[model samples]
Target: MIRSVTMARAVAAALLLLAGAVRADAGATFRAQFGDAFLDRYWALQPDAAIAVGYYRYAARIAVPDAAYRARRLAFLERSIAALRRLPEAGMDAAMRTDGAVLLSQLEQERWSLAEFREWQWNPSLYNVADAFALLLNTPYAPEAERLRTVSQRLTQVPAYYAAARAAIARPVREQVQLAMQQSQGTLDVFGEALERQLAGSALRADERARFLQRLRAARVAVEGYIAFLEALDQRLARDGGGRDFRIGRAAYERLFGYAIQTGVTPDALHARALQEKERLHERMAELADHLWPKYFPDQAPPPERVARIGQLIARLSDNHATPAGFYDEVQALIPRLEDCVRTHQLVDLDPSRPLAVRVTPPYQRGVAMASVNAPGPYDATAKTYFNVTPLDAFTPAQADSFLREYNHWLLQILVIHEAVPGHYVQLVYANKTPSRIKSVFGNGPMIEGWAVYSERMMLESGWDPSPEMELMYSKWLLRVVCNTLLDYGVHVRGMQEDEALRLLRDEAFQSETEARGKWRRAQLSYVQLASYFAGFSAIYDFRESLKQQLGERFDLKKFNDRFLSYGSAPVAVITPLIGAADVSR
Candidate 1:
């Protein structure tokens, strides 16, 4: 029986590899291949992955791949990259050629990065594949059977995944234990959310309810068992060896950052840039703030009392302005207006078929007060875009006032512009419809983020706001972008302490204690991600000006945007060439 089971496992693994090998030579467009292989695989097992791939409906039924499956997937990636490299770029159009190169480069980088995952080193966080799946399953879009299948698959793999995790850790017992505890907490949060959904559903048939309950219980038991396994692993690792750290060394860290983010700059250089930008932005913000609130005080100076009073006023405004429906109404209303504004200004020719919507954040994933747009996948022509706003918790009087003050109406509008209209949503909608699927999938962050950040300034330049209040709000958000860049670099490269980081946030960005704390945690958790916003926006602005000069009267804003977004998402390195050499004619 044991031999037969082992043989079955071996055969299954072989079949998966064989399938991948055959698919590699199928001669499908890179978009179709990625959609069929990578997107489809994760769609049912990891909804967050699906969401990232622009498949919200199947998000609930997706599970993170098992260890064996991950291994096979890696092998398949290698095969696909090999096949892609052989494709002739000579026959392709400029867009296609650019896309192909970017895709190939991204594939190589992804493969190298994935090699670092010797075990389940990234399991506990909300960004993790598992958490993404858990959130998706709770959505109404997923069918029960598919959800069950995904759940069953995840449950069955838990033991083995835990075992692999135990074997891979090269750290001390305490660290392992801490990791396990965090994982357990995250898992419990997910399970609790799932159970709440099931219990609240009055539409469930008796049998369906029973099934959900049974599965929920089973999941709980499995999670507890995995936690126990981790505890045991931690004890063993500690006893066998003194607690050792398992962090990737500097070289590996550098390689991963470069390949994954497509930035050649060192962390140190990035950090220094962030610091300089931060100071510049803070100065700009101070000037703007002083100009905006001149009525409350006489002198054009930074008065401590005035600053404190302004903070109080902001808090009051935020409280008064916050709607229970959150930012959805305001965001939805602004989309069309901004679209019109952009068109009126000849900023970008909007695609009629481009999908865009404002959505409330998923219930299971609240607490984070950030908004973002989920871009469509390379091949998916259905550019279903979501401008997701984090929901406000049912707030106490004090909390409500505090929350409201920071997220005032002007700030909210700016956020809408940044997250929706001419920001991410507009950029991605065009990207999806772009001819090159490969470029869409492998598009660079700097271009995407940079374009969005650049929009903030463009809006102002186009006379969207002339009031000091509006200008201050704009500058404050810019300050955030600056702060994000600084903190990301500082945490990762400069080894800045948390206290220092908090001080910078408070003094420079004017972040509240609560906001500062959250930013501090986010900075520590994510590296070099924040820099993309400022760095990218700066590069994009420079490129746009250079393009305007080159194109002269031919440099239509709408046409430029339409063309820029049409290439899909790719690194600026590849994108810059496609835009052609800067024609100094403006």
Candidate 2:
């Protein structure tokens, strides 16, 4: 009996060794086949995206948004998905597995976008080439001569690019067509003066310079041609009163929410959560306002209604803001202070070597959000991360005052915390450090936005700018986050109109009238994006709290933060399990 048992054990051990060998071989094969070849093909199909991500080999290639190119892209996506699925799961380590999943999700989303959702069919603004051209001019990724040469090559394709765009667009959404006209007109600057400046600085031979100048003029004409096409479309739609509806409706929004968020929470559930969160925030804000009422009002009794009291207090606080002329300068000055807060608090280890620059938003990229972080590609980890703030330079005096009040001093600090320090900039710096290029490149939207939203609260909790007034303003700021989800879900899914949306923002959320109007316009122009801030923040904050409970006294804040960010910009759903397993094992 003992001899028989020993023989059986030996047989089992040998089988295990064979399985290990199979896994190792599978891993090697998968990497060898998919690593470089797949990326080269993928980047070739998406040259502008390649430029954005620091893949410079495709810098001069321009993708034509025509039916044939799209069909080819769809086929590529399907084949890649199939190829990824063929890889043995046992072969991949935790990081590799996560990367594989991230890449797969990205592929599936793109496929759905082309085959099912088909934004390319309806969204005229999707065809803008200015951002790519602007990147070539401004990114400093290559030397002036090399970048200018790329511009010259890319200009050759501009006419064909716009021709394809014009053909592809049919019965486009009215809001999107208007946006396309504005943006396309703005892009003429990049091709004209911007190109002229670059050409003036370039050492292109006399002949090359002449050809470059000629191409520049042609590119400008092509851009103007596209704008003219949009204007004609607009006029036709205006006369006929026929255009595609901006609302994506419930089905498309739900599907997109799944792909973009990946939080394992349904849009219905997230919407419900936002409603509950809004109520809780309103209650908290009211309490704080009540607490500070006597100080601010001195003699008058507080309003009996909850919103009225909160509104009164916020109105008083809004007065303490920068003038219109000082808004841009104020944002720039806040960056250093935010840097010091994170360092002093030891919130997370920051890499000062990674540069973050504050700059005005490029004209081609304006009309979306007021501020955004332009992070370097994972491939170019050391490049500058621009904090692009849309200046109020052209706003009328009244418009500027309303804008300044919306971004009052206390709220502006929270904005910087969200946009710059310990927010998008800090998280992206760490995302670039992550070894998985897939996770860094196919970054989860909710994860990126969530970390930024979370950073706002995190900084406040760490006692930066500790004051009752700051606390009150943060509650109001956080209400905006919650309202983003509510507003997006309302507009896209429930067919919410402008009047209702404006009231939700201006009344319930205490946003200024100008802010409310802007958000209403933004909501129409985009879908499933505003909710990202709330969905991401909730998942990340919940994960941290759950970890705190699990670890008890042993839970270290800095370690927890650093380790959480180490996973790159992956879905919080994926990172939570890895974090839990790692902590439990430790």
Candidate 3:
């Protein structure tokens, strides 16, 4: 007995020593990797750094790359990848290993895609950077002193960034000419607007005002040069099938979809699935529409006239209930109701750490808002959430009516559920607390968007119908998702023209021509992004149902949600592996 006890004690001691060694090694490695990442080339590309450090401390004083800087950037990226590759992956925990692997893969892919794929050679518009600079400077989150300092510095770099941008325009490829043109226009607008804002402000010193004017002139010159280049490029591409051939080809597109989205499904397959789901949603909508609108206008026919009249009546109802003053008021009132719904359904765990609020979209991004929620970035400890609604401006009485009718009490409740409560705000609050920076920063849009859409349907399923009118609105939104998928695939793969795309939007989604046209433009510019929402939502729904069946009595909403969100916002591919399930990838 004495001999056995001694042996057991020795074995236990050895295990403790081994565990201590592992922890020590991991702690050092974690700090080193994080330190390197915080100071590395990745930081150079990030918008927050530009806003927080570049503008304030440096005073927009960085030199523009002239061959040397470009070489340095390329080398830095390569070295970072090589260094990360050399890091020991053996001792890390599952989460750490997953994050490390994903980061390494991302680094390698970015290097290959940008340097070898000649992406920079073809799509060299610095306007994206400029826009990032503009937002960082202008947004309310930044301190005033920081904003002013950064604004001054960025304004200083404007000339150099614009010059580089113009130089890039000199060698435009055929396929990306339209994108290039749009970028050119966008950059000019940014520079012009910034200059106008700076000059108009009373706080600027004489030297600052003069500097702003000088930079403004240079920016204008660059814009003119870019325009000239576009005109020439357009003519050149017109002879070679109008740049249609210049796109991320099938293999490359697939690779990007896999890397960026972490989904194995091809864009075409996803689009097809979106269409299928869309049809299913429309059938549900039609049934609901018939149930509600029959009282207002009784017609049992289920074809063209019924559909058209139903749409007309919805518009008329929206008009009748329109209240110009009540938009904000209505939205505010629904918050408590949404909270109660979540608590009553017990869909998921609500963290006390999570903070949520509703606000108007900033003036600069108002053009893009139907409604949106900006999640706190990876590093933020505070869970700041913004539920931004676009303010109405200069709407005619008829237009106002149409708009207000859509925001009736029940529809407003649905919107609240969709945008706040257990939707984006809730999901993002969980995501913000995730430990993996790589996963948090490179979050899967599909997962984020999919969760929000699923939440909308989940509320409806939970017997909180709000009203039939609201149900109809939800259906209309679902139809839009279907149309969005069709339009995305139609434009990118099937070569659908603008007019044809708009026609489909109007006929299928029941959108006004103005809305359809706007969607068509968005479809042209954004390839396959919309399909992520529907595709993602469908996957979530399936995963939830399957898990419920598999777990049976063990199934707990709070436990499942907490476990799922703890994985962060990685691609479905990575997420599927982490969750130990094949169902989510589908």
RMSD for each model, in Å, please? Answer: 11.9, 1.6, 5.4
lDDT value for candidate 1? 0.62
Stretch of 10 with least lDDT, candidate 3: 50-59
lDDT ranking, best first: 2, 3, 1
For candidate 2, lDDT tens digit of each residue in 1-586? 9999999999999998888888778778767756777788999999999878878888898998888999899999989999899988786767767777888889999999998888887889998898888877777777888888988999899999999998988778989999999888779877777578668878888888999999888888889999998999999999997788999999999888888998889999999999999999998898899899999999999989999999999999999999866887898898888888888988898898996898988888888888899988887677789999888887888888898898998998888888999899999999998877777777898999999999998888899888989998998999999999999999999989899999999999999988899999999999999999999999999988887787777777787789889989999888887876356323
How many clashing pairs per prediction, in order?
22, 0, 4
- State which candidate has the highest lDDT: 2
Better of 1 and 2 by lDDT: 2
Order by TM-score, highest first: 2, 3, 1
User: Candidate 2: minimum summed lDDT over ten consecutive residues — where?
Assistant: 577-586
The Cα local distance difference test for each model comes to 0.62, 0.88, 0.64
Look at candidate 3 and tell me the lDDT of residue 417.
Answer: 79
List runs of model 2 lying over 4 Å from the truth. 1-12, 581-586
Cα deviation at 522, candidate 3, in Å, is 1.3
lDDT of 1 by residue, 447-563 (tens): 788778888888888878677767766766787887887776666555678889888877667776766876776664445566788767766777778887767786666555666
Clashing residue pairs, backbone N/CA/C < 3 A, model 2: none
